[model samples]
Target: MQKEGQKSSKYDFEFKGGKNNSYVFETNYDITYEVKFKPSSYLFDERYQFSSQVFEMVIAVTESKNLDDKIPPDGLIMFTIAEIVTDFFKNRERIIVYICDTADARHLARARKFGLWFEKFKTTQFMKVDASITDEMGVIYMNALILHRENPYFVEIIDAFRKVTGGYSEDK
Candidate 1:
């Protein structure tokens, strides 16, 4: 793993925090979440208690330790996996879920039916992704919550993240 202040080049980063950050295992999912930040994602850390993962460089919130039910959604940053789940459960009407990936139709259909549980999200599209790590294989996804946010409060999460990580340039 790269050390502190190591120049950001082309390295695959997975989303993880808290004690789980110590892990190095990979997931079998296809979607890649491009979590944008203000700068080089430097402010967010384990304190937020968010557990995340990535297909390539894009990070996704898989779990959280600290969660608030009433908070409005911004762009979702610096939060725990618990918070994301709580927010989703609390406001199912306003949130839309998206499960993105580069898996084939058979894999995708199986995942959708056996793995994902959805309450919102009117449509889902599966696309092919080009990841530098493995073969040119990956998935890029765009998902918006059902609730429209005139002012995204969670965007701050991304801002802080870019600051801490030192460089936040991610691929689409």
Candidate 2:
């Protein structure tokens, strides 16, 4: 039970300032994860180009050196991620786009897990919109756009995301 106005996660994390806007944290199993928020405004340029900040959030296992490692479930990981997201929203007008990795064909599962996390930890100040599409090769891509509720370009951002996703709206 996180108190209002308090950070979501009880775990500690550090922001590794670099080209990719990375944040790092370690789990109890000694597994290290790096969460990167990369600029992805180009995805919206074709639809609704705006100055509002947009980024793609990518979470990967580092240090372990093996993407196939069978890591045990760590609830703290979600807390750390929620904490990072809380910090990122300090600007109050940014958007985060998260596309699940499809290398193992578990994109849907990943998206579901992320959606659960967002539903669990998301505050009232934020909103999430989900979209899914199958590419020409029939690869399903699942993504979510998270943004601050008070963002000045809220309508534009949602409209742009809808356009980018071929008029798909989760609300509809």
Candidate 3:
């Protein structure tokens, strides 16, 4: 946890750049995580005629050889994520889409935890919007889009997302 008045980055674990726009970091618990930003503009291109930059942010546990149980809460994990996001926004304007994994049937819980992390660590220059949809199979998918507040196509991007998600509401 960060002390009062301390920057969030101060608590971030050291992370290194990985192949294909991925960031790799290891937690104090010895769990390795890989955060990747995969090109995903195809998701919006055909439907919305959109031509801007968009990536699907995927975070996964890359190596957990020593772990045999569920991972515990680690504040540094959120800090590391925040740092990677900050780095991603430094160069250009882009949209990051995060869809929680539903394989374990805990996607809602994952989404809630992600929401808490974003709410606690997001900077003033950042903005996030969330949406949820139920597929024909009755599986619910929760997703979030994060972007710089100064993005040129901010309004259009949000609109495209809303249209794709069946006009789902935004988060305040």
Candidate maximizing TM-score:
2
Candidate 1 vs candidate 2, TM-score winner: 2
For residue 126, model 1's alpha carbon misses the true position, in angstroms, by 23
Model 3 deviation from the true structure expressed as Cα RMSD, one decimal place: 3.9
Q: What is the TM-score of each candidate against the true structure?
A: 0.20, 0.87, 0.86
| lDDT-superior candidate, 1 or 2 | 2
Tell me each candidate's RMSD, in Å, in order.
18.2, 4.9, 3.9
Clashing pairs in 2: none
Candidate 2 residue lDDT tens string, 1-172? 2333545445568899687789987765567788998987787784454543888999998876333678877677887788899898898777899999999999999999998998888677888999987899999899898888898888888888887887654521
Please give the lDDT score at residue 168 for candidate 2: 56
Those runs of model 1 whose alpha carbons end farther than 4 Å from true positions after fitting are 1-44, 49-99, 105-153, 160-172
Candidate ranking under lDDT, highest first, comes to 2, 3, 1
The superposed Cα distance between candidate 1 and the true structure at residue 13, in angstroms, equals 36
Best-to-worst ranking by TM-score = 2, 3, 1
lDDT of 1 by residue, 99-146 (tens): 334443343443343123222222222111111112334543222122
Query: What is the C-alpha local distance difference test score of each model?
Result: 0.28, 0.81, 0.79
Runs in model 3 deviating more than 4 A are: 1-19, 46-52
Top candidate on lDDT is 2
User: Model 2, 24: alpha-carbon shift in Å?
Assistant: 0.5
